[model samples]
Target: MKAMTYERFGNADVLELKEVPDAHPGSDSVLVQVKAASINPVDYKVRQGHLKGLIDTVFPVIPAWDVSGVVVKPGLDTPEFEVGDEILAYARKDFISNGTLAELVEVPVRTAVHKPKELSFEEAAALPLTGLTALQTVRRAGVSAGQRVLIHAAAGGVGSFATQLAVLAGARVVGTASERNHEYLRSLGAEPVTYGDDLVESARALAPEGFDVILDFAGHSAMQTVPDLLRDGGIVASITDHRARDVYGGQYVWVRPDRANLAELAGLAARGSLKIEIAEVFDLAEAAEAYRKLETGHVRGKIVVRV
Candidate 1:
């Protein structure tokens, strides 16, 4: 199979297109003919060796985690899917040796969920990692109807999803983005605030007493102000851990692949209760270019590599 591979960890320059052996399915896994895969910040972080503590890579590693594809074969012990079943999954980076930046991949049945019939492969591919991250952050913040929820980096991958999910959960969503994304965030049902000196004041104006929940995906030093922007007993969750320990008075959010959650999200997408945004799509051969675009941090939604 043809795949995007890296001989060593570094910049996107290190990735190349090459032929690699097809992976075999394990007893509890399924081999997917990958149709689309999304790029996450973690993909580049792994390439740069920044996630060494969590991901130990060998040379010629394939790095991608979010995938939407069809099952070509299901493992002996797997019954969740069968041949030709379309599915979306947040692949467990540990078992998939090679990531989704390939023509095919083997993912555990537990990590794979049925794809939403309402979405195309590209849209489903974009949902896993970022969707899960945003879902977990919102849950951690305990956002409820009528509460004011503040989301940082409102236009980026996870942030975009967070805004929509928070709004759906009945929170008066407030999101921070550049002026360019303000309208977009509002479309997602959020009150948008531009990231700048008066961000706090702007947010305060929107909710005089401050937010009831703060979820920060843009772990910049600015996240440290989230606590001050929250009402007492309100929660705060950070995807990037802006070291706001002093003011958190809440929980830190770390995303994990939960098949049940993915399944629920799939249902939501199918029911129109959630949305998946695909900013762009690149052919698998253009993985390097995809990484370059992702690093720019200008994407309105997710970027996918079509396998």
Candidate 2:
């Protein structure tokens, strides 16, 4: 099987397309024939060794976690899935190797869920990590009907999902983005505010009383505005910054794989209540290029790599 492998932490230049051993299912895991995989900020971050202290790296590492593919075989203990089942997963393991960027990947049943027929493989591939991150943050902040919510980076991959989910919960959403993405944020049901020195003023202009919940998907000191933007008793959640909890008495979210949450997201996509936008699609051999585009940090939605 051909995969994008990197021997050591570095830039996208380290990624190489080469033939590697084929993957097989292990107990409680499934071997998926990859149809598509999506690129996340973490993919590039991991490639650059940003997560070295947290996750041990093995040589010749395959560098993606999100996958949508067909199951070619299931492990003996995996009664919930079978051969020929189409599924998607955030296939992160305790260690870094055997990822989904390859033609074949071993996905644990704990993280895999059935892909809805309504989603194309590309769309399904785009949902897992970002979708789950958005869902977890929103739930942590207790976003609900009639509440005022603020989302940082509202036009990026995870922020896009968070914006839509908060809106569906009936919250009035104010999202931060550049002027170019303002219209795009509006389409996702958020009142768009431009990010800059005047961000707090702009957000205050939209919601004079302060927001009931603030979700930060952007890490560049996004939590600095929490004191000014959140209501006295409101909650905050940040995926990028620990200050949301350590300093602000809010939650710092690390997205985990939940089969039920993935299923709910899939159902929402299938019902047309949630939208998955594909900013660009690249072939497997061009995955390094895909990472470069994602690192640009201006993509409106998800970048996918088709196998």
Candidate 3:
């Protein structure tokens, strides 16, 4: 199998597209014929060696989290999937050693879910990590109907999903993005707010009392605007700040994969209650370029790589 891999963490420049041996599944894992995969900010961060501590993977790593593929083989006791089943998954962090960047990937059954019939493999590939992150954050914040929710980086991967999910939950959604993405955000059921100086004021003008729940995906240092935009009793969750225990007295979200939750998200997509936006698509050969775009953090939605 051909795979894109990094012998050592440095930058996208260090990634190489080359032939690699196929991966075999463990007792409770499934071997998937990867049809599509998506690039996340974490992919680039790991490429650049920024997340070595968090990911804790060795060198020569296949870097990808979101995968949509068909099961070619199932290991012993893996009852959730069978050969020939179409599925989507957010591969676990500890297993980054062999990822969906390859023509095939083998993962534990716990992370896999049936793909939404309404979504193509490419679109389904784009949802897992980002979708799961948004779902977990909203659930952690106790987002409910009639409350106002604010999502930072609303035009990006997780933000796009978060906005839609919050709205579906009946929250008045407000999202921050550049001027160009205002309409797109609004289409997702969010009142668009721009980021920059007085960003808090922009959100405040929309909801004078502040948002009842704030989910930030704009990175740790960029989440400084969250506190002011949140209602005093509101909950705040940031993919940027996982250790926000002291920073936000409410809840802090640490995204984890849950097969049941992934299934629910798939159900939402199947029913048209959730939307998966693909801002860009790249071939497996263009994995480097995909990672580059994710690092820029300007993509309107997710960037997928077709295997």
Candidate 4:
């Protein structure tokens, strides 16, 4: 099978298109003939060796974790899916080896879920990682109805999903984005604030007393203000910095794959409650170019790669 592979840790320059051995499913997994895959920040970070100390990696690694495809074969021990089943998965493992940017991928049955019939393969591929990240982060922050919620990087992949889910949960959402995306955020039922000098003040102006919840998807110093932005007993969650625990008594969230959550999201998408925005699409052979675009760090939603 052909895939985007890297010989060693580096930038997008290390990735190349190459034909490799076919990926076979493990006893509890399923072999998916990938129709589409999605790129996430973690893909590039792994390529750059930023996660070297964390997840184990094998040489000539395939890069990506989100995939939507049809099952060509189900593992001997996996009865959840059979041949011809269309599915989607956040195909992450304890170690980084096989990945989703390929013609075929082996996904653990535990994390693979039935694809939402209402979604195209690209749309199905786009949902798993970012949607789960946003959903779990919001849940960790314990967002609820009538609360004031603030989301950083509100127009980016995870942020967009977070904003919508928060609104659906009945929270008054305040999202940070450039002025160009303010209207974009508003359409998602969020009040937008520009990200800059007076971000905290701007956020304060909206909720004078303090926000009930703060979720920061944008790393860097944007979270430095969370300690001051929240109302008493309010919670904070950060996907970028675990140090949020020390600074604001908040949770630092890392999204994990869960079939139940994915299926629930599939239901939401099917019902028109969850919207996925595809910023761009690339062919599987163009994985390197896709990584270049992702590294720019400004995609409004998800980027998909058709296989």
The TM-scores, one per candidate, come to: 0.96, 0.99, 0.96, 0.98
Residues 145-252 of candidate 1 have per-residue lDDT tens digits of 998888889899999888988888988888899999988998899988998889878889998998788888887666668656988877778878835444566677
lDDT of 4 by residue, 1-307 (tens): 9998988988888888999999999999999999999999988888888888888999879989999999998999988998999999999988998899899999999889998788999999999999999999988888999999999999999999999999999999999999989898999999999989999889899999899999989999887787678889888899999877877788998899989989988889989998898999999888898889988987899999999
lDDT top scorer: 2
Whole-model alpha-carbon lDDT for candidate 1: 0.86
Q: Measured by TM-score, how close is model 1 to the native structure?
A: 0.96
After superposition, which runs of candidate 4 have C-alpha atoms over 4 Å from their true positions? none
| Model 3 TM | 0.96
Ranking by lDDT: 2, 4, 1, 3
Q: Scored by CA lDDT, what does every candidate get?
A: 0.86, 0.94, 0.85, 0.92
* lDDT of model 4 at position 99: 93
lDDT, candidate 3, equals 0.85
Q: Give Cα distance to truth, residue 251, candidate 2, Å.
A: 0.5
Q: Candidate 1: list runs displaced more than 4 Å.
A: 242-247
Clash number for each model: 0, 0, 0, 0
**Candidate 3 ranges beyond 4 A from true positions:** 93-95, 220-222
**Global lDDT of model 4:** 0.92
Per-residue accuracy of model 2 over 1-307 as CA lDDT, tens digit each: 9999999889999999999999999999999999999989998898898988988888889988999999999998999998999999999899998899999999999999999999999999999999999999999989999999999999999999999999999999999999999888889999999989999999999999999999999999788888899989989999999989998889999899999999999999999999999999999999999998999999999999999
